[model samples]
Target: MPVFLTIETTCDETAAALVTDQLEVLASVVASQDKLHQQYGGVVPEIASRAHVERILPVIHETVQRAGISLADIDAVAVAYTPGLAGSLLVGVTAAKTLALALGKPLIGINHLQAHIYACRMAAGRDVFPCVGLVISGGHTCLYRCRDPLDFELLGTTIDDAAGEAFDKVAVMLGLPYPGGPSIQKAAEKGDPHKYAFPRALLDDPNTLDFSFSGLKTAVRYAITGPGRHDPSQVKLSDQEVADLAASFQEAVVDCLVGKSFRALEITGFHRLCVGGGVAANKRLRTRLEEEAARRNVDLVIAPLKLCTDNAVMGAIAVEKWKAGVFDDLYLDAEPGVVRRSSALIHG
Candidate 1:
């Protein structure tokens, strides 16, 4: 079986993986930059790219070593090059291109969002195309109609801040830690989801699929500080107050995500739904999705907690392109922003 080397550095996580053509993950390694970014309350692009440069080689070396294989064993080199920070994407793309050229191997460029959806295919151990894919993360909150492993139609995307970005911002407002998804989830456990009644933007608009989390995030800020209040430093919140705010903010985000996702299903008529990304790992969101999927009788495939976050293993989606004989030249460059199709909102 042919083996592939996959690199992922779309964001703060630096990861590499070795996988067989049959989708068996022989070895996977990831180096996280959470501590580096934690103090900033969010990712600093320069810090992230620097970390990737420093960690990518070691990660790939460790993955190859763990797989008991030499660089010569790799038939192809795949790296996610689009829809991420420019510097971070360049680090991975440059490394992959160099390795591919050095090994005389084919270079495959992976779409970070599509790879997130492919994490479901990896988990299922079979084909999972022709489904609705929802990617919820710090950088993205969008829905796609997956026509195949590589073909995706953008159904809807965030008009402003993403769901996970809102989480991180809200966490900061509440004086919680960075990488807000987990921290907020922990604080929310003791609070009530219905306590504050945060706004669920665009939820009532049955005609449009685009999401707007900016308003919701602003609502959280206003709740913490009065309507005209700008600084949260003036307001001292108790443990219970903080927890309640966290729970309420999280609930609003989840409701918007779930509502829009199911709406995409209704519009696209896709029976199976695959969700992946950092926010997908939230316990409350997972439970809500599971319960709703059961009630709606929709097949829901969520990337396991281990796979939910950014990782090179998901880059195995390159296998599909490989079989199709699709490959990129060494001239491939990093695309920092999401290149969306001309089609905008999916109107019902």
Candidate 2:
């Protein structure tokens, strides 16, 4: 069994893992800088990049050690290369390339979004193709039709604000801590979702799979800053106001994602729905997805919490590619944008 060493630095977390072709996760490690970025209320590209540089080597070393494997035992190095901050992606890509070249192993480039989708396989332990994938996070909000592990079709994506981005913005408006999704989710548990009714975007049209959350973000801004506007510093949102706003905001995002995902399942006639990315870890979102998916004929697969963010174990996704002899040279470059690829829809 070939072991693939994977590195993921597509965002604030620098991670590495070792996995076998059978998808057994030997060891996975993540070094998170959430606390470091919290003071800024969001991730600073420079700070994230520097954090990756410092964390990448030690994390990979420990991952291999924990797995009781040597670097020479791995067959390939897979790294998430696209659809993330350029600086952050570079740190992982550069590290992976360095290790691959030094160790004489083949290097594979994995898509960040694809890694997020395939993270389900780690927990599900089986092929979940012909499934609808909804990836919602601070960086992305997209839906795809998956026929297999590697094959994916882009049905729709966010036009402006991603679901997670809206969460952070709304959280800032409500004076929540940084990395707002979790903070908001926690606060909302004590609040009522219907206390403030927020707009639901793109629910009317079946043909339109695209999403827009900027207006809802704007609505929150106006609600806090007051219409016809006062300085943001002029008014402080009460704690109740913040909680209600958070509940309403979280509800709006979850409703849009869950609704559109099922609609896509209906359109594609897929029997399974898979969700991942940072936002998928939300308890409310997961509950709604499970309940809704059960109501339909579709099966629901949610990635484990640790793997939901940019964790390297998702690179177990590279096993099929390794078996198929897919590898790259050390001269690989990071592609930091939503990629359109044909081979993405095939899973197993």
lDDT of each: 0.93, 0.85
Q: Over the full model, what C-alpha lDDT does candidate 2 score relative to the true structure? A: 0.85
> Cα miss at 306, model 2 (Å)?
1.6
TM-score of 1: 0.98
lDDT of 2 by residue, 95-132 (tens): 99998899988999998887888999778978888788
Distance from true location, Cα of 106 in model 2, Å: 0.9
List TM-score per model, in order.
Answer: 0.98, 0.95
* Model 2 vs truth, CA RMSD: 2.6
